[model samples]
Target chain A: MLRLILKDILIQKKTLLTAFIYGFFAIYVFGVKYYTNGGFVAGAVAIGYLFITYAVSYDDKNNCHIALNSLPVKRIEVVLAKYLSVVLFGCIGIFTMIIDGFLAELFGFAMPKNYVAINNVLMVFGVLLVMYSIYYPLYFRFGAVKMNIVNVFLFMTIIVLPKALGEFILNHENNPLIKEVLNFIRNSPKSVIQILSFAAVALISLISIGTSTRIYKSKDF
Target chain B: MSNILEIRNLRKQYDKFSLKDISFSLERGYIMGFIGPNGAGKSTTIKLIMNLIKRDSGEIKVFGLDNIKNEKEIKEKIGFVYDENYFYEHLSILEMKRIIAPFYKHWDDGTFKKYIKDFNLPPSRKIKDLSKGMKMKFSLALALSHRAELIIMDEPTSGLDPVFRIEMLEILQSLIQDERVSVFFSTHITTDLEKIADYITFINDGSIVFSRPKDDILESFALIKGGKELLDKDTRKEFLAIKENSFGFEALTDNTDRIKKIFKNEVIIERPTLEDIMVYTVRGEIKCLDSY
Candidate 1:
């Protein structure tokens, strides 16, 4: 499983370098200038997504699945390796964000507000888990080529979802159910929310991995 | 476990094509030439043996263990070469090797290095930089480096030039000299098998035409040339397929002794090559209808 994940990362070494420079640029111009912590969240998500998707496209481009399956590795290992790769890239994304933060400070640029806050980290991890949880089963079923349109739709949903939710809350501010839900959230403990959020992400990821393994095991090369 | 690879009544169904219940086996320390025309279920069978595709119904055993139940263990000892280059094109050969080498339990870096040098493959060069022949050599080098007991090659010589094909054949020949490794080589190119294959398994239209020792196959099948008048409906049944022209009739038959007994030297019986057997049998039923 480690080798498989390493293979994905090694093949994208050039892309990773370019992404580092690009991440710094984004955090500098768009990150610091725009919505403060949102910039970091957006940058990390974009880089993580780009890395995993590019690795998948590389496999599709070269039909490496056939080669990989012919080796001693199990089908479940391949599926797990892909899920693990998202985590690896997410860590790399966060690590790069720290380096970018330092680089910005060295150049005398103001750092984004609350860039490394625990909430931001949790949000980034949650968003990645949700995105991959939805994306991977479909990928394992339809493959990279057939999932192009679906991928765009999924990415668009991720970009538009927060704004849509905010608008819904504003539009329904007078509604009793909405007010009650907002009050409950306002009264809930921070640790409880964190535990619930972590549980939800873990549950979604487990289901996704199960679905992907089932789809991949019965697949023909 | 004399048989290193075995498939019994294996089947796979696609939209337009299906591999009907096909069965064949290869013993240890011998090369079995899997010869068939295009779309003849050659690759499908190999894929089934490798468990790359799920078999509809049947049993496939490799190294005397169930293929699916023991897939990872079975694959640890099986090296495969497909017709196309499936390695990451952007990565160098060394990088590709690094990724694949850890999967096999018996992966030998020294053996891999020796092949890289012998095949003249630049370790640092990207896979896409290699030519077709070079890419195939790179694939063979990888397949061979792990001390695989059964080497399954699916049309490894299809697009290669004659010289390189011969070179590949020589490598297979030399590998079997130790009498511990067996090769199951699939190709429509029958001549390569003629030189190195110990047994031949022929499939056509998703069905097995024959699978037997190469010499037995050659000895059993005969190409007979005779006047068209001799090919009546009764005598034609003896031939698997027949071709008739204005001058004479040339037919392929497995029953050479029966033909000799019936024709009484009136027909010319000659030894048939593997190509003759494959072509005649594949195109058999459709060729000689008008001659009747």
Candidate 2:
């Protein structure tokens, strides 16, 4: 199974190269403009998510599921192998970004505080966990073709809702105490809160994996 | 008696077409040709037996074990080749072997090496760089090198040229010498099956139209060509299909011996080829005539 997973990754070497190039350009632009450690972490997390999404979508498009099913391996092993590949790539992307971040800092670029950097890393991972939690099951049920459209809609909702709510909360002029509390929450200890958020995200990811696996076992493929 | 594979009442339904109750068994050391037209549920039945697709209702036994319950064990001994090449296009054949070698317990590097030499495959070239015949030969080499007991192929020879097709059939013929290896290959090329298969299973409209020994089918069915006067309504019922022109008529019949006795000197009896039987069976045009 490990060998199969590695072969799949190797097969998509061109896609990986494209992803890496895009990541480099995107991160370099962010580093030049924003020049914050938090931005690096955010960039790394985004790239990781993009990698997972591309890998899953490619496999779905090529009917790799059918090919894999024809092999001697069990269905469960196939699923687990996919998840492991995502994790493996995620770690590699994160590590590469960390090095890139440090190099920028060494070259006299402005950087965020260490606490902010740490918090950004945690938040990025949190977002990825949430995104994968929702998307994996959707992909499993509806397939990549349909899920791509659904994903666009879901992404729009996620981005739009938070801004709308934030504006709504801020416009309430009569609630001075609520404003103060919200401000404090926003400015709280970056590391501790980030850790808590990541823990929650990890827990949610586990639940999603369990749910996806159950659905997959019952699936006709 | 230790049949390599057995399928009982296998059924799967789709919106377009459904596989009716289909059943067949392949004994050890024999090649079974699964002959069918396009959309005849040949591939679907293979998928169900391999557990790539789930059956709506049926029992599949491979190597004397339940296919689904003991799929891993069953798969371990079976090697499969799809109609098209499914390997990663960017990887070289050698890279693919490295990746797949660990999956099978009996993978023999020496045997794999021998196949590479026999097939004359360039290990360093990526799969996409190879021709269709080369790609298929590579797939065959992989399927055979793992000490597999059963090889299941879906139209493995459909796209190859005549030379490669014959070569592939020859390799399969040699593989069955041990009496432990069995092959179930589906193909539209009846001539290839005629040359290699010991048993033949004909599928039409998602149903098994005929399944019997190749020799038996050849011996039992025949073609009769005679003059237009032979085309009486009564005799037409006995033929599977018939073509009539101004001068004469040629009919295909399953009961060759009986028909020979009935038409003694009026018609000429000749051996019917597998292709003739397939065409006649599919068109339902067999007819009999009284004129010579």
Candidate 3:
């Protein structure tokens, strides 16, 4: 399973190069203007999931899933390798950004003013886990062609959902439940939310892994 | 002979094409040629045997164990080559092999190096840089290096010119000389199999037309050519397929003695090639009243 994960990363190393480009671009942007810790981290983190999506495209192009399955590995292992690889890429992405930040400072570029917050990093990771949890099952089921269409819809939804929810919460400002929810958000410790969010993402990711393995097992080459 | 692979009542259904109940067994020390025309469920059956595709209903046993239940063990002992190459095109041959080698407990570095030398495959060449035939050699090198007991190939020689095709067939023939290995290969190119296969399992549409020894098929199956007057509704029933025209009519039959007895000296009864069986089985029946 570890080997399979490594294979996915190694095969898609060419695409992973773009994440460096994105990091350099982020460094350039931070140098010129206002860059918060959150903003710098977000720029770095966005490209982490691209590793996974790109690997899917690589597998689709080369028909590697069939080749991999033909070997002495379980279908579930291949599915799990995909889920685990996102975390690996996530670590690599964040580490690259840290290195890039130090280099930018050394080269006489302005650095983000704020320190990296543990709570914010956890939140970002939580969101990534949730997105990947949902994304994989869809990719496993419909594959790259149909999933490409779904990705656009998903991107639109991601952009629109927060605004729609914000409007709903404001519109219901007078409601006792809405006020209680706002109170919880205001009063709860950030760590508590982060831990709870991580738990939820873990649960969702487990469910998605199960779903993907089932879909992949029955998939025809 | 101990059976290395056995499949029974295998079936997979798609909206357009389906594999009917397919049953064939390969002995431990010989090759089985899986022959069918395009869209004849040959590759589908191979995929089912590999468990790369799920079968709707059937049983496949490799080395006397249930294929799905013991997939890892079965696959560890089996080497597979596909019609198309499936590798990280950017990875050098050594890197690609490094990724695959850890999976098989029996993988031999020495055997791999020997094959690389024998096939003249450069260790540093990326897979995409190689020609199709060279890519196939690379795949075969990987397949053979693990000391696998069974080699299952899907159209392993489809695109190769005659030279490479013969070379590949000869390589496969040499593998079986150890008497511990078996080969099951599917192809539309019948000549490759004609030169190497011990048994032939012919598929048409979605079902097995015949699964017998190659010599039996070569000897018994025949083509009958006769005047157009000799071919009619009653006579046509004797042959599996018939192509009729004004100049003459040719038909294919598996029962040569029966066909010869029925037709006597009135028609020409000749040996049928594997290609003839495939063509006639796929085409089944054709009509040509005019000689254009």
Clashes of each: 0, 13, 0
DockQ of each: 0.86, 0.47, 0.68
Q: Is the docking of candidate 2 incorrect, acceptable, medium or high quality?
A: acceptable
Off by over 4 Å in 2: A14-27, A115-122, A149-203, A214-221, B285-292
Candidate 3: tens digits of C-alpha lDDT, residues B1-292: 6799999999999999999988888899999999988888988998899998889998999999999999999999999999897887878999899889989999999999999998899999999999998899999999999999999999998888898788888888999999999999999889888778999999877899889999988888898999998877888888888888879999888888888788899999888889988888777732332322
In the range A1-221, model 2's lDDT, one tens digit per residue, is 79667755665666655655655564566665665454555566556666676667756764667656766788777766766665666665666676665665687766556623545555556566676688877788788788877776665554356568778787884598877867876898967665776688778888887877877766765
Best by TM-score: 1
Residue A148 shift from truth in candidate 3, angstroms = 3.5
lDDT of 2 by residue, B137-238 (tens): 888888888899999999999889998888889988999998999999999999999988999999987889888999999988899999888778888777
Residue-by-residue lDDT tens digits, candidate 1, A36-146? 777677778777888888999999988899999999989999999999988888888877877888888799888866778878777878898899999999999998999
> What lDDT is obtained when candidate 2 is compared to the true structure?
0.79
Candidate number with the higher TM-score (1 or 2): 1
Say which candidate scores most in lDDT.
1
Runs in model 1 lying further than 4 Å from the true structure: B287-292
